[model samples]
Target chain A: MQWLHAVPWDLLLIQTINGIVTGMILALVASGLTLIFGIMDVVNFAHGEFLMLGAYIAVLTIVATHNFWLALIIASLGTGLIGALVYVTTLRPLLGRDPLTTILATFGVSLVLQNYALWQFGPVARKIPEPFSGSITLFHLDYSLYRLMIAGLSAAIIGGFWLFLKFGTWGIWIRATTQDRIMAQAMGIPVPWVLAGVFAIGSAMAGASGVLFGPLVGVDHAMGFDWILRAFIVVVVGGMGSLGGSVLAAIFISLLEAYSSLWVSPAQAGIISFVVLILTLLFRPTGLFVATPK
Target chain B: MTLKDLDKGQVTRRRVLAASGIGLGAAVLSPMPLRYALAQSKPYRIGSEQPLTGVAALGGKTALVGLQMAVDRINKAGGILGRAVELIVADDESKPDSGRRKVEKLVTEDNIDAHVGGYLSNICLACVPVFTENQVVNMISVCLDTTLTTSKCNKYTFRPYDFAPSQAKAFAPHLVNKMGKRWFIAYADYSWGQSTRDAYANEIKGNGGSVVGTLGIPLGTADMTPFLSKISGDFDGLFLIFFGPDSINFVNQGTDLGLRKKYKWAGDGAVAVASQLPALGDKIEGFVGVDRYVPVFDPPLDTPYLHAFYDEAVERLKKAGLENAAPDRYVQSNFEAMNALKLGIEKSKFQGRADSEKLIAALEGLEMKESADFPTGDKLLRKEDHQAFVRETIFEMREGKYHLLDTIPWQKSEVPPACTFA
Candidate 1:
């Protein structure tokens, strides 16, 4: 009872909001990765590059339009288009080939994009002013309202995407394609186009997350790197190629890291994600949220 | 070239491709130098390793610019001892393994006379033994890990700029007296950060101040919200030791969490480099820092030679796509490091790797005066540690520009030699 009283309940409560806010952003980023992996067996190393390009596009859009919302939309559309182009030019030719080639291709694309950003943007981190400059005090914290907006907006976007998958015509096409590619193709669903569309949708989600999270940190060529790593962990932990499971895992990992920071340093708490990643691989390779395969 | 698109009808793709290939081959086999007028004498090959890609690429890019600037100047002024200073640059890729491999190549394959660049401290530390083993005079550029000149000091390496210990000694008094008594140090959680934290912590305590708590975030961590949330309790100032993107991330996230309002922001001068000012914007305002060189023209720093150096650097940085970027300490150190090597070569009348001992002897206890070459100011490359001490600039960022506060002379900032090179 005395030991329990020693806990800083106020800090714990604050970490809850921090975790959820961070979790939502992670979910948004991971959702795209999981979506791509779900439909296509391609492990996109360049997913982070798309996110960086999204932030860069958002920077350009905001400069021209001065509207954060417009920047988000333009960034998403821009990355989605780029995603389709990449698939058509690069990924499409190597579809039935070994998956390692696609991974390597995306990695090569990542290097090109990262260097391209540096060459074009010139190593300086760009600023994206938050749409709102307000904060709300909670217990012992004065958290940014923009951060809260990020979480809410991320949830809304993810929810909307989920709904689209549930009801939209293309959504059923993607779902059917994911279930059985050959069968869906036999049923007249253009398999190549569906794969391209899925990649575009996933890339669009990643781009949106970038613009949403851009204001919190300086938008640079490598901004997506940290989040993408955690997103991969979440993708693995939530079960690879499973969108719903990935969302849950993103929140789980973010909350786990945040709450653990209450007792351990953030650096040590970060290891919690990797530890869980290893454990999940060892104990439940199908992921914590995934049903054990028969 | 794309500019050679004279006519679409005449310059077809095949013809254009053929012309481009020929031009590329001509440029590669016999590259032209527009700056220097030197004899046909064999050049002094200087090896440089910087992160041309990966996380620290920005700083590494600027560092090469400085190294090139110095080499150009040296060559323009009758080259280094009548031979052109040919700089052989290697992209470290910001990894220790790659850095070690590149340095090994620069030494064994390239057969460089001496080495002139190393941007990241961890890479520098990793590559130290290679230089010592190969008996090359390694002039460190921007790596600020204190151990380079202190605990892990090496015979082959010479740091011709201020280290963390000197900076901490110079800045700690001002921080304790002017800023606040209690501080919380948040560092990049690597060799450089860890050493710099200890240096500042020791200096702060010595100045009758205290470090309340410290946070160590891993390098390249873009989102520090999770770590930064734990840094709330009570602290007068947040002492940061991060550079490049990591610093940008820390300041932005820390400010977003109301940590900026709660605590007085002050840290290394790197937190507000001229290139990063555009990214940091107004968030970095009022942040005070100390550095060996800032792109400022204040009192003692506003020398004619520095202006010359500054003008050239500004022009060159613009050419490198860093528009409006003033030469940071990385540029300054690399420029001076090459210059220091030149003086050593001249002093010893050294020719190549065979004259390594003579070069080392000449460089030991080297005294650099304020000039176009050493624009930062007078420095003493102390014999014991081979670490140069220069005037530390204490400044505040106001309206996205640096305003000088007080200058700490090298003598005032000097810590006793703590190295015995093996």
Candidate 2:
């Protein structure tokens, strides 16, 4: 009871806000990963490298253009092209082969991308230009303006994506292909082009999130590995191929991290994602929000 | 045998007979022994291994530059013991198992006489037992875990720079006496961080100061807001033990959140590294830290030897076309360790393990005075634990540069007493 009274309420409030912002950015990255996996049935081990490339593009573009918003768009488009190139040159040929082969190929591609980034940018970490700096007081609580802006931008993009998936023509085609590729092909849909489009869209989302996170954590060749791991965990705990589940699981994981660090040490909090992942596998293999196929 | 015959490239009977007679005489004299003797007189090799890839690649490359600079100088001075010095380098990629395997190969197959390595603590710890088993003289350059010199110290290993305990001890008195008595600590959650936290806590207690709070931050933590929000109070200063990229993130975020205005800051030398100063800009101004070396220092402490070495190192880096190369603490520590190794080998006339015992004996309790080699002034190699005691500085960052505030002369520690070497 005494320890309960000793809790810092103000600190708790700030961490809760931080947790939401973290989850929002995570969902932005995880959405692309889950979408690609759902449609193509190919797990991208190099998805994190796409994020790293996006960060580098953002930083370089900002340095050249001196406009954060323009840099973000250019970086997204640039990474999308690279993602499409990867699919056409490497992944397209591996279609109809064993899934394990594609997995190993992507893993190899991850190593190559990491080393290329190291060679191109050198080992020093860098930061993207801040769209906005400092903090804002909301409801008498101080929150970082950069974080809040990122959260808002992420929500808008995610919401827009959800709307497209629900009503857009290309979105309907992608959904139909994801459900039944053979039937979609028989229905006169270009399955290969749809798969390529899905991969490009997913990579573009990852790139945008990476650029957004650049100001918060800085950019390094190794940053993608950590982000991709967390994104994978989010997608797994949310149930693969389930968009709504991804958002919930991402927020849940972020909250677990925030509160766990408040109560336990930060070191222990780092393992919470893996711990939740193991527990979910042991008990409910389909995840909390995942729907069962009847 | 005539000059005209040789020029014409003609093999006359007389020329052939004369050449055969000379060759037979030379063979009979048995020149094979002389050829073998010359082959055996090759330069002594020092195998240098560090993670040249992965996250720790920058530090490893910087340390290698320092070692290479020392090697070039020693070779130019007509070598040591009439034998030129050679440095062979390998990358461990920041993996402990990789470090062990590389060191084993260097010692067994490459026939390297001695070794100097390992930028990260875990990698250094992994190579310790291998060095012990092989009886190879190992010079530690960068890793700062105290256990390497105390509980884990071996007859074959020597640490030439300040460890975690000594660094914390040197900084504690300044924080308690001048700054204030109440302190907060934010340390990385690992062996290096744990040891630093323990050392500072003990020192603070010993000096009548009290720790208000302590937070164990995970390494590579991208977000520091949650951790920083928890720290609130009247603590005079915050002690940071984070390193590399994490240090940059913490300082940038912590300052933005008004923690910089609230408290004085102190930490390891990573806080004011040259590479990070531009990114951090004026955010880390007024920060103080304890370090092995700094390129800029107070006028009084600037010895002529220090200036000459710094100038030469900078020139060498420029000549090699390395833009980011600067003589930071990591470079200086490795440079100093290489100099110590050179002195030990020359004094003992080292050949191999059979002669390494003598080299180790020669280095024990060796005091080096201020000279071209000993740029940091007088240093003592403590006979007890084989750790060098050198002068350390407490400097404050002002105007985007580190200005030395105070100096602790001949800083020594036997904090857990001497290693048993059991």
- Every prediction: chain A TM-score: 0.98, 0.94
Q: Report how far off residue A63 is in candidate 2 (Å).
A: 2.0
Candidate 1 chain B weakest lDDT stretch, 10 residues: B31-40
The digit string of per-residue lDDT tens for model 2 on B249-325 reads 78877876677877989888876766556556577799998876887747756789889878877776555434545
Residue ranges of candidate 2 with Cα displaced over 4 Å: A1-8, A137-142, B1-40, B315-325, B411-417
Compared with the true structure, all predictions reach lDDT values of: 0.90, 0.81
Cα lDDT of model 2 by residue, A231-289, tens digit: 89998899887777888898899888888878776567869999999988888778768
Quote the lDDT for B168 in model 2. 70
Give one digit per residue, the lDDT tens place, for model 1 in B1-422.
44546643456789878988997676566643522222236899999999988888889888988999999888889887678888899999999999999999999999999999998889999999999999999999999999999989988899999999999999999999999999999998999999999999999999999999998999998778878878877779999899999888888888878888889989998888877888887889889999988988878777898899889999999999889889998888999999999999999978889899999999999999988889888999999999999999999988888999999999998999999877
Model 1 lDDT at residue B51: 93
i-RMSD values for every candidate model: 1.2, 2.7
